[model samples]
Target: MFSHIILGARDLAALAAFYDPVLAALGLQRMPDEDDGGPAGVGWQLPGQRLPQFFVQLPFNGQPASAGNGTQVSFLAASREQVDAAWAAALAAGGVDEGAPGVRPRYAADYYGAYCRDPEGNKLCVVCWG
Candidate 1:
């Protein structure tokens, strides 16, 4: 039951470019918003809804953005193949690999996932349970 998520980045434009294909592989798109303006923040919606957006931006306090060591944002994939594609897209976009796409048995037998860090070190995972 989350409404939205905003990921802070040091370079907003680069972050957006890096995430474009990664999210597109999961069928999400960058949502258009003219009012949420402040720096280069952009929101990506979950296909249909306008709210519950995901944003990447520089810090609102005008400080350098830092990644939380324990924080991770995850995107759901419709299938394991999409998870692999997402991982490849991330790496192609200059992301560092945290974990390759595979079934993480520790999480679940069907928990297929891939982990990576964005250019600014934000951790993310593309996972599939179905």
Candidate 2:
């Protein structure tokens, strides 16, 4: 029911740097060689997906990293190791730790999840289901 998921950012470059590795760990490769310079300044595709390939474009009007409240993105990790790696990387890359990586026995005995706010305060999560 959705065409594509595009987010407004204050800086496409920084956002890409933040997103690329985390998504890649999930087997999503950054689409290469596609820049149109339109409102959607650039695009990155996750090849061979069930739905439309995902893309990230520059915010047409305002600055990049304009993520607002009520916005959250979750990337799945293959194992708890990945979740820990993601959390560490995010912290090094200017993300604020929202929740530490560990099993949330309250949520579920094996619900391992890590949460952080991106440079723009968007709630991003890396979760592992063991």
Candidate 3:
């Protein structure tokens, strides 16, 4: 249903560095040839699973990037182990922890997930729905 998501990042390089490994751990790869020039950010997408793309870039209107309250972008994982790996990768890349890897019973019985904020303060969630 969604074509793509582009989160504003004051520092595009920092956001990309922070997310590179996190996305890789979930089997997503950055599109190296995806530079659109003005205020464009890096893009990542699942191999063979196109349409939905994730990007980090400066605000198109030249506004400073700010984290929105209660706003988050969640990435789906393939396994519980991937969730754990992604959480660790995020931390290693300077992300702050919002939640550790484990079953979020409130979301579902098998909703294993981890939550964190990117270097730019954008909220993120990685989950594996069993």
Which candidate leads in lDDT? 3
Better structure of 1 and 3 per lDDT? 3
Q: Candidate 3 deviates by what RMSD?
A: 1.3
**What are the Cα lDDT values of the candidates?**
0.90, 0.73, 0.90
RMSD of each: 1.3, 2.9, 1.3
TM-score of 2: 0.76
Superior candidate under TM-score, 1 versus 2: 1
1-130 per-residue lDDT for model 1 (tens digits)? 6888989988888999999999989888988756656766877877777666788977889999999989999998999989999999999999999999998999998899999999899999999995
lDDT of 2 by residue, 1-130 (tens): 4546676766767877887766665566776554466764444445765454555666666554467678877766789988988888888888899999999999889889999987767788889888
Which pairs, if any, clash in model 2?
Answer: 9-64, 9-65, 10-63, 10-64, 10-65, 11-64
Report the Cα lDDT for candidate 3. 0.90
- Comparing 1 and 2 on lDDT, the stronger one: 1
List the candidates ranked by lDDT, beginning with the highest: 3, 1, 2
The TM-score obtained by model 1 is: 0.93
lDDT of 1 at 6: 89
